[model samples]
Target: MRNPSSTGAGRLLRATGHSWRGLVDTWRSEAAFRQELLLGAPLLVLVFALDLAPLSRALLLATLGFVLVVELLNTAIEAVVDRVGADWHALSGKAKDAGSAAVTVSLLVHVAVWICVL
Candidate 1:
């Protein structure tokens, strides 16, 4: 969706506001997101403390970021699906499932990367 503001700075400011609202809404409503944060935040701190090669450390960080990004996208997908209607539809289920699979795949890769790095 196009931002209402015409100027670049205005648009950026508006977008940031929208993003902040999204994060707030998601955090308040989504249990899985909160759970992920509980797990990921400490792992993030642990990553910074560990002595590791730069490349490995970066890979670990990237994987954690990837999982959260995918989770956000999945949440967006689920929200859109619900907004469409309450009725059960095959296509909607497929879209939700696909988004969930993306998160699962990201998590698997995250675990693998951490294992390899350790």
Candidate 2:
């Protein structure tokens, strides 16, 4: 029989693979994901150009990471909503709106952090 640890490692690898595929799917389907990538890639390059303090650089990195993560979650929420139905039910609308709010909050945090740091 295979070792239990090996089996567990296989499961973990499979799960990671699924998540990576989902990220790519999200990127392809979601306009917001593309926008975030466009905005964030340049900002990340600018971050390196700025010659920032170590602490400031760390904060900027954190904010950029937050934007990426939140965008992913928003895309996931939207995908689930679309999968559920293209209908305009109230709960479905709320779920999409909440996902939008999450993106907004993340953006606000990014703005606040960068403004404070720079």
Candidate 3:
């Protein structure tokens, strides 16, 4: 068993490692995640390059991050669905669709934020 007193910083570091591993695994397995990172990366730099109010800049950045977060969640849902069974099922389909819709809504929000800011 681990020492309870050392849990604070140690736990945080371990959690960060797990999160990084998840990101790496997602990048490897999910093409959509890779594509979003590819596009979002340069777009993020461009966002900083633009002359805008501080709030607008922050909103734009937050929206971009939100899309990536949604995409990761969608990927996780799809993975879980696949793991449960490879066969087609109505509930599985519904879950996957809902996850996809979440990503779509996030993308729409990103676009809307950009439009409003620019």
lDDT of 3 by residue, 31-63 (tens): 999999999999899898999899999999999
**Residue-wise C-alpha lDDT for candidate 1, range 2-53, written one tens digit per residue:** 7557569898888899999988888998898888888999999999899989
The numbered model that scores best in TM-score is 3
Relative to the true structure, candidate 1 has a C-alpha RMSD (angstroms) of 2.6
Which residue pairs in model 1 clash with each other? Answer: none
Q: All candidates' TM-scores?
A: 0.91, 0.85, 0.93
TM-score of 3: 0.93
The clash numbers for all candidates, in the given order, read 0, 0, 0
- Arrange candidates by lDDT, highest first: which order? 3, 1, 2
Compute the lDDT for candidate 3: 0.93
lDDT of each: 0.91, 0.88, 0.93
Off-target runs (Cα >4 Å) in candidate 2 are 1-8
Candidate 1, run of 10 with poorest lDDT = 1-10
Please state the error at residue 5 of candidate 1 in Å. 4.0
Give residue 22's lDDT in candidate 3 (0 to 100).
92
What is the Å distance of residue 44 in model 1 from its true position? 0.7
